[model samples]
Target: MLQGMRLTADKEHIAVVLNRPKYAGNIGSAARCAKNMGVERLMVVSDRDYPQEEIRQMSTHLAADVVDSIVYCRDLGEALSGFHYVVGTTARLGLARGPVMSPRDMAEQVVELSRKNDVALLFGPEDTGLTNEDLRYCQSVVSIPTSERFRSLNLSHAVMILCYEISMAEIGVPERFTPKMASSRETEGMYGHIGALLQEIGFLNPENPEYWMMHIRRLFSRMRLSAREVRIIRGICRQLSWYLHHRG
Candidate 1:
């Protein structure tokens, strides 16, 4: 039996989000992985009921507390609402999907981002991975390297690999001070404000707003904007709104 595995205060900031998971065993195993890595929070986005007994059985003693405290959300957006940096895991890739990184690279980046922001690692269902709509909420995507013959990994295995990488990441003290980055909520508000301004300026087509907005999101997500930068952008939006009103 695994003993003395406990959650820490810092681990609370990193949440493992399972989106529309299909099986109870996977959920339990994932919870076990989270506990093993010291991540206490587990967020589930599922509209259906799960087998509680099986989940507990699979989780064993490693993740009973985490499974017990799982936060249930109606959708991916709600699950990721409070996070500052959201990383989605997927096996597939496409042009519309944003940049994809290997697990190791993503872990290093996540470790740095987690310094000042609440970070979330998002996993899709057992069958189909996160849909395009779900990926829209994520700033980055990570794929675990596997043999080409059988690329797909089990849900719990994926979680374990990611959690292990994150746990092994060596966070070093920075020589210079840096400002805190904006939270997901704040950045989302700025996007909304920008969208409104774009509509008013006749820049975004009401019929196809996504074409431009997706690229804009990708651009900004890559920049990893700080809180001060987000505020500056919001200020710019406010000025534009004032200009439009005065010119009328």
Candidate 2:
């Protein structure tokens, strides 16, 4: 910890979201890591109820509060819907993954965002990292650079690295005001409307809207659109729909 450096991001607003994690121990270890770094929220997205004792055993007393307050969510949307910004963690990359950020760089950005917004660090299952569908919900993706020999990292280790970088990030008083961006729920709604409108105009394949939409998501994710901006885009989409309908 840097001496006299104030931790800027609100711990209450920062969350570690586990998407379909398979191991109880990993969840516990993640809880431990989050607590260690002053993050207090943990959300698990899965239907199955993991073993509490096993979870607590690994988390121990240090993170017992994290485990105790863990919010169990049914799916990805419910897990992420309330978040103003979500960062997905992945080991693999492709054109579909969109632009990737290193953990340190992401932490720097997130520290600022968390001062006024809700942010989620989404980690995938231990077997496979977040899928393309999961990445769709994320505004940004982070990949930890590893040797070519082994690109993967243990799930808990990934959480620890992200949390540590974020916690240790030293910042002077920010000159610019960081506004609250659109929530995942609101952003998804905007995408849905835009997708329908694009297909209506024959710009996207009606049979394969998602393929084209991935590119669109990348374009807008970079914008970090606020609720007002999202509404503006959707409002234009609505007007376009009306104009198209009235065209003779």
Candidate 3:
């Protein structure tokens, strides 16, 4: 980890923000993308629930640490606070929104601005996308150039594209060796507890426990759950179970 940091000499800094994403799988995939691209910080702003099992599994082992490191915010204002430059991603251009640049152009701008001050890139949710109000907070806007008819992209794919661009820009020099993957010990127990909880809640369904376990294994294998994060999630499940069991 230290070596990876040293390799960059800290040339570029990036913060990826997910604004009120509607799906858990997107969040998980985004985490994996962020990790793959060497993005260090991830902020999630939403009132909706996260798809922990789906995301963890989708990210595979590569992005597990990022899932563990996620920070959740209730509002976009809180998510963008303390950052000097903010960039928002959108597919549609509004009369009020600023000029839309390609993702590469956005990355270039980020590199330039980052040389002067800190920067954050924002991504809106799945269904409604970023509202006009959401664009108010950004200094600029980036639009991934897709077909005019189909400009929309999955939130995780967008995150991956931007994070990769930024990471490549920051790590200008080639790395001699690939970075290490998170250790199995990091998320193993959490998966076990979650599996048990799912079984308890009937979220895991199969004719045979073995078949169900295999399905669970394939689904959660992507999460790369950390010890602390697993503990926290398991605690949530435990509390919910207690409430349900005792509820009148």
**Number of the predicted model whose lDDT against the real structure is largest:** 2
lDDT of 3 by residue, 9-32 (tens): 122456788898887878888877
Q: Which has the greatest TM-score?
A: 2
Tens-digit per-residue lDDT, 19-116, candidate 2: 99999999999999888889889999999989999999999998998999999998899889999999999988888888899999999888888988
The global C-alpha lDDT for each of the candidates, from Candidate 1 onward, is 0.84, 0.90, 0.67
Write candidate 1's Cα lDDT for 1-248 as tens digits.
13333222245578999999999899999999888888888988989889899999999976788989999988676677788889888898887777799888888777666767788999999899888778878889998889999987999999999988988775455544544667777888899999999999999999999879989999999888888899999999999899989995
Instruction: Provide the TM-score for each candidate, comma-separated.
Output: 0.89, 0.94, 0.61
| Cα RMSD (angstroms) for every candidate in the order listed | 5.2, 2.7, 17.7
Clashing pairs in 3: 24-51, 56-222, 56-223, 57-222, 57-223, 187-225
Candidate no. 1 TM-score: 0.89
Candidate 1 structure lDDT: 0.84
The list of candidate 1 runs beyond 4 A from truth reads 1-10
- Residue 201's lDDT within candidate 2 is 88
Q: Any runs in candidate 3 off by more than 4 Å, and if so which? A: 1-12, 170-248
Q: Cα lDDT for residue 230, model 1?
A: 92
